[model samples]
Target: MSAPPSPSSPRPRPRRPGRAHGPGHLIGAYGLLALTALLVLIFSLALPRTFPTLDTVDSILSNQSIPAVLALAAMVPIVTGAFDLSIGYGLGLTHVTVLQLVVHDGWPWPLACLAVIVGGAVVGVLNGVIVVFGRIDSFIATLGTGSMMYAVTGWITDGGRIVPGPQGLPAAFTDLYDSTFLGLPVPAFYVLALAVVLWTVLERLPLGRYLYVVGSNPRAADLVGIPTRRYTVYAFTTSGLIVGFAGVLLAAQQQIGNPSVGLDYLLPAFVGALLGSTAIKPGRPNAIGTVVAVAVLAVGLTGIGQLGADFWTVPLFYGGTLLLAVGLAGYAARRRMRTGAFAARGSPTVPPRSPSSSTQDGGTAGTTP
Candidate 1:
């Protein structure tokens, strides 16, 4: 078959840098490495007595789960170029709903948890429908939904906390957050497992391509036969489901459901999501990056707490980091586009064909039709 199709003219192999895909990805990965080192150094010096200890590490891992979960919830919709402001509010309502069901309504704990999770998913689908059908911006849609959820929470508990009675709730349910496995906190394991599963879904599946396409150019994706609206709905639904699970964890962890505590989680969750777009996969909302971003914030906040910094400082730090991360993400995206375009221009192109009129002069076309 034509001398085995010419061994010297084999298909071009994709260039790889070590274990990573390319120079761009390697740069992103290295940036995360540098950031992790910087965080460790800063925390080590700031909380010299406690920051480096295993117990401190365990504490950070333990306390960070809820925020990390919420951050991931926010990040999901972000992959489709949308925002879910309802997550924080949803958490508030979900916890209260679960607690009320258990304590006030005398429902089983597992059923209460399930009902709340389903409610979150329903809310998420509603958000998606409002955005998709009503043509409302995702930010505005989620904002309105969040406000409604907040009002519902206030109505449910009359703006008071819901604490489980000793006989009403099972101790095993509380242990979902408090227990440890193999010397590590259970929440940490759950976070790791969830992150891994989400990473696979986002990075190694066609669903991810659809999300990227929808986010980057929804009209174009639609034109290319991708069901952008369906994918958008899926993103919001997944986000809502995750947020519901996070609320369950919150209730379990704190052993009480208070509407007041949830709104405080919003800023840090958004900060983690935005900060994630700057590392590990710069300009993309990646699972590993989100977790790492949450870890960085946890470590920093823990160190500050240990150093007796006031509570207000945490919000200030989160807001500042978010602004910085947005700037970095913008810069990285633009730079990547420019470099890609330049590289494309430098590559070879096939020659254009001349008219067949030359064939009359004993000239034949060499190019395939």
Candidate 2:
């Protein structure tokens, strides 16, 4: 039999380099960021008078903040391999609820805000129950629940707007959206703060690891003794709470309740969330990535608007970008899987020895063959 590998023998090196440094890795790593920069540069050159101004910066930040928040919210459920389509409808219902309480019921803004936020949590819990215990697919389940939310929103407003009294919404409430700190909109700060919080939770906390494991492979997570269902529920609940907060910001920003506004956000939110998976972490849904994705969209959209594009341009751009994002995300996922498979196949293996060979090897030097 051949001798065992000698202590001084060199190990067989892998045929391919590290996956993280493989060809095309650079593209996957910084493609979106580079595109964002390119867009900014182009816009600055195209509209030197308008695109590079502080006003444009503030506009992008202020307008994109809600969608950014909603995108982050959508990402939470995705971490646990689930979806929450109801976010849009929930936002509508939540803002309307807050308005109804403060305007019609004469409730204090703080109390009304608290009630709406709590109600959002309840809606999240219901979604969790439906998805976990009821065994309904998250997409279909959330769709149904979202429809119900829309129905409820319509009933609340009787298909009419909820405008605040002549005195206008409480200053504190409006200030939540309108106020600027350090030369930037408050909502932009909200986005940053929320991104930091989410990043900390997902990158530095055990719960985040559990959710990721559950998302990557629920069966494997279960086999490893992880309470996958519980974490999945937690993900949905967290997503609901974030959506609720975004709704409050929406209410504060608009100062009126319009049930239709929520649905308009759904597409952009999903675009940001899914597109984000292809950036920052590359192949995983992450908060910072989502924020970056939102920023990219905001820049692109704002730049295009300044170019005097037709009314249909916005939808066209978003639709095309969404498709591209999905395609790129799928490509990243497939590439990761290929890299893993190649690594697995290249791993060293030991050949099994027969019983006779084992016995012979262990025998004395004078032993018979």
Report the CA-based lDDT of candidate 1 relative to the real structure.
0.83
RMSD of each: 4.9, 4.9
- Estimate, for each residue in 117-183, the C-alpha lDDT of model 1 and write its tens digit: 9988998899999988889999899999999999999999898888776664677778889999999
Runs of candidate 1 exceeding 4 Å displacement: 1-25, 166-168, 348-369
> For candidate 1, which ten residues in a row score worst on lDDT?
12-21
Error of 1 at 157 (Å): 0.6
> What TM-score number comes out for model 1?
0.88
After the best TM-score superposition of candidate 2, give how far the Cα of residue 184 lies from its true spot, in angstroms: 0.9
Candidate 2 clashes between residue pairs 3 or more apart in a chain or in different chains: none
Clashing pairs in 1: none
Steric clash count of candidate 2: 0
